[model samples]
Structures are given as C-alpha cells and as structure tokens.
Target: MTDGPQGEATESPTRWKFSPVQLDESEILRRGLDAFAELGYAATTMRELARRLGVSHNFITVRYGSKLSFWRAVVDYALAGAERERNQLLAEHRDDVERLRGVVIQLYRMSANAAEMNRLIADESTRDSSRLDYLHQRFIKPFWDSIEPALNGLMAAGHIPRVPTHILYFAIIGPALALAQNPIADRLDPVATPTAAQDRNSTADALSGLVLHGLLPPSGSETST
Candidate 1:
C-alpha cells in the first residue's frame, strides 16, 4: 500500500482499502449454462443460477433484470467471441471453396465447445416460444444468412447437390451438437477425458469429415477441397 521507504507517512498494507469491480459475470453465466442444460428453462431459477456462481442470490436479477433477460445475456456472453473466431478461420484461406470448407470444419470445431448453447437453442426451438424467436433473430438466422450464399454458389457450381439450407445446416448441426443432448456417440467410442482439447478436435474433425465428404467415393470431388 505504501512505497514511502522513509516511513514519514504511508498507508500500510494492513489498512489498505479494496473494492471488487463486480462479481465475474461470465463465470456466473457459464454455471447458468450448466444449470439450464440439466434443468431446462422452465425449471432453472435466477436464485439457483446465482447460488451456483457463489454470488448473492439477487445477483442475476440485479445485473440482468429478469430470468429471460439473464438467459439472453448468457447466450450473448457465451457466443461473443465466436463470430470473430469464425472470420479469423475464414481469413486463412484464399480459395472461395476452400474458405467454405474451412468455415464448415471451423463450425464443427466450434460446436465442440458450443454444444451447451446449441443444445439450449435446440431445446427452445421445439417449443415455439419468444425465447426461440430471440434466438432465431439474434443467432440462428444470422448464421444461415452468412453461409447460405456460399452454399448456393457451391450448389450452382455442381460442387454439392441443390438442397435446403436447413437440411444442410442440420446435417452437420444434428450430429455435432448431440454431445450436449445424448451419449450415443460416447457410448460408441468412449473418451477418456471429455473436456480435453485433443478429444474435442478429434470428435469435431471426424464429424466434419463425414458431413463434408460423405461415405461414397467423391470421384473427383476431393480435388475441389
């Protein structure tokens, strides 16, 4: 607290005043993710979410206003860095097609870490709630808007068959996001450490390979990649 070596007058360390800026918001929301993932939206409470974060019971309501607002904040906080990262991944490639491929693989890689958010949206989507509308407007539609043009171009060029964007989206999203919903993939091939980076990448790459390449011989399609 004091740098006065002469000790003429100084605030001592023992008498130092301290104030935390605020409780860590991101940490609280992450635990919110876990709680919502396990308990679903109808069941999770702001108090429980705050408690799980080891903060005051009123923390969520005070900072975020309401349960729905807190959920939106959780989603925004969880995904804040993803778009930039995806753009960074896209920047690595020169070819348009290669960029698409890179982005797809990047998405699968993203899903590895984003399974909770993915699963959350998936759960909400089936219910047709205002929350689902928020997710669609804020997250889902933007993703399709970003990628659909490329997909259409690929289709026009005969790189991939003409297909619905939702179909293609779910073709990858379904299997990749199942990590948060089910254990069938794990049961088929168990992972020693579920949260390890290596394991996550391996799972993502495998899923991407299947979705991108498919089972049958591409004949000459490998050259496009």
Candidate 2:
C-alpha cells in the first residue's frame, strides 16, 4: 500500500500508537544456520533468509547489516553453549584425566546436538576463507587444544596410544560425529528406537566408554613411559 498524496508515509496527528510483535528469535537463528550450512556463503542471501523466516525481505539485512555478520551471529549462537561448557570443565577439573574426560563428554554431547554447526565446519574447512579462520580461532582450535595436557600426561605414562593429538582428535570424535548422518544412524539401528532423552544418554555413554577404552592403559598396564 502506497502512502498518502505526496507518496509520504502517513503519521498519527495526535497520540502515538505502538503494538507488540511476536517473534521467535531462536527459530530465526536456527533457520539462518541451516541455510548457510546447506547453501554456501556465496549463495545465501538475506532476502531469501528473511523469506524463509517469514520476516520482511529487508528485515535481516536492515537488522544484521550484512550476510557475513549474520553468519557470524549464527555461528556464535550455535557454538556458545559448547564453548562455555568447555571453559567450565577446564576450570572445574584440575586433574589431567579428569579434565580430558569431562571435555570429551561435553564435546560429544554438544556435537551431537549441533549437527548443522558441524556441517558448516566441514564446508568451511575445505577452503581458506575468513569464515574458516573465524571458526578455527574462535571455537574449533580451542576445543581440540584443551585436552592436550591430559593427552601428554597419559602418553608419558604409556596409558593412551602415542598417536599425535590431531589424529587422536579425529579418531575419538569420528565415530560419535557419524551420528550427524541421521539416515545411516536410522537405517543401521532400526530395531531399537528410543526417546530423544534415551538416545542422547545412550549415545554419550556408549561413545565415552569406547573412547576411554582406546585411550586408557590396561587394568594392570599403568606404568610411566
């Protein structure tokens, strides 16, 4: 609808009027994350994102300034909880193994919940872009490095295998990370269907046991290397 006579927006002559607007901010960010992850940065547009969220075409651009900025916001919202938990584990667990295990479990839990973030990470990791740099510096590197001390200590004691931490990182996370592929997960285990809570708890418990078994020394094989 066009404005009044001179193509100017009509305004209230007397009292001001304002109404409430209902918006789901979390849903907006989740949709934004999925869009960017599914469609690469070059292809994702603010107008399209707005349409997906049922907002005004220019709303995202006006509010977020640019697409890159919006992408950063989405990444932050998705990874913030995991980052916070990583810091908490570091602060609370003083012992080497304790800290390592705590961080591993938290990472696994967060990773399971953050499949879109993982997909985005996988996409960005293929190229040398600023988004990749931001992800590595802001979230990914710190997480992988947090367990180095424990790894070293265990390695020195002939506990875990002497694999480099990077390889070890992929080794420990790869299996759990496979949960991101819901198709394979559903098809492979069709006989046992569990509630979301039951699935999450069972996944964590099973992965933790599998990882620790590969890392920790045998019951009687704990000797300093």
Candidate 3:
C-alpha cells in the first residue's frame, strides 16, 4: 500500500513519426550529372541512378520523362552553374590580366572538380552523336561566345599578345584539361605534394600563373640575367 501510493508510472516517448523527407531536385540532378559523367550516356541507366540516389526508378522517369532528357538536364545544370560563376568572377575583377587569371583559375577548378565531365566530353568528341550536337549548341557555343569577346578585348588592349582566338582558347584550356585527365600532374611538378593534388586553390593558382606567364608579351631582353 505504501509503495503504490509513493510510485508513479512514466510514459515512453513515441519512436516513429509520419513526416516524409522531401527530395531535392537540384541535388538529385547534381548526383545524376556526376553519374553520367563517370559512366557516359549509353552506360548510365535510370534504375542505376535511382539506386545510387536511394529513390525509386519511377521517380526519375516521372520527373525527367526519359534517360536522354535527364542527361540533357544534367548537362544544362552543370554548364549553367559554370556560366553563373564566370559572370560573377568577371564582375568582381576589373583588370584584364586579373580577370583573365580569375577565369583561368575558375576553369582549372571546374576541370578538377568535374574531371568526369571532361572525360565524358572527350569521349563524345571522337564520334558524331545527337548528344554531342546538343552539348555543342547549348553549352560549348555559349561559353565561347561569352569568353571569346573578353579574350579579344584583352588582346585589343595589348594586355596579351595577339593570337588566333582558337589557338589561345586551346592554350588556356588544353593544359587544364590535360592536368585533370592525366595522373602525371604531380610528377611533372617538383614541389607538388600529395596535398597539392587534392588542393583546388593551389592547383588553380599554379595553373593561372603558368597561363598568365605564357600569355604575357615577350620581353625585349632575350638573355637571362
């Protein structure tokens, strides 16, 4: 009787809730872009993507309608993000040299971050395909359209030596893509530590320096002091 009067029962907290977690479309698209970049268009399947993303296959199919459409969306998303970042970088830097350095650095970082995208594009370049056409029209052309003018302006102002835009374009992008694609980048640089391979800012700075030095006007003094 004394124990009954002194004791009170405690209630347990509920273990389950009914709220459903919402899936972020942008995040899903980003993951899809990475997958397609790694696997390419022919190899990447909606079911596989869904498995990787931990969602139903129907979810992707319903949202994107088809694998090709989804792939287009992924490409568009990645390119659009790059364009936005480039625009912001241009707005922030006033000097042509500084602006060009910023652009090179940004492209270097992008190539490093999206190495798979570079690989995928490289693969696409060897053959003719609708996807390649789509990429050229939608992404590549627009990118060049925006960047070529700035590069031309630099040349016009005599900040950089005059050269064919296409040649200059390759000079700027080729090294960055090669570094991203090749495993020999660390070996090529005497001071490239293990950390440098993974360090985006370090890679960007080094690449920008090299590109800027190459683009600069030739000094009249041919002999080194």
- The TM-score leader among the candidates is 2
Measured against the true structure, the TM-scores of the candidates, in listed sequence, are: 0.76, 0.78, 0.69
Clash list (residue pairs), candidate 1: none
TM-score of 2: 0.78
Query: Global lDDT for candidate 2?
Result: 0.74
Candidate 3 structure quality by residue, lDDT tens digits, 94-126: 776667777777877787677767666666766
Please list the C-alpha lDDT of all candidates, in the order they appear.
Answer: 0.70, 0.74, 0.70
lDDT of 3: 0.70
Error of 2 at 118 (Å): 3.0
- The RMSD (Cα, Å) of candidate 3 is 10.0
Across residues 129-173, which tens digit of lDDT does each residue of candidate 2 receive? 999999988887887788888888878766777876678877776
* Per-residue lDDT of 31 in model 1: 80
Best by lDDT: 2
Worst 10 residues of 3 by lDDT: 12-21
Cα RMSDs of all predictions? 7.0, 5.0, 10.0
**Which candidate, 2 or 3, has the higher lDDT?**
2
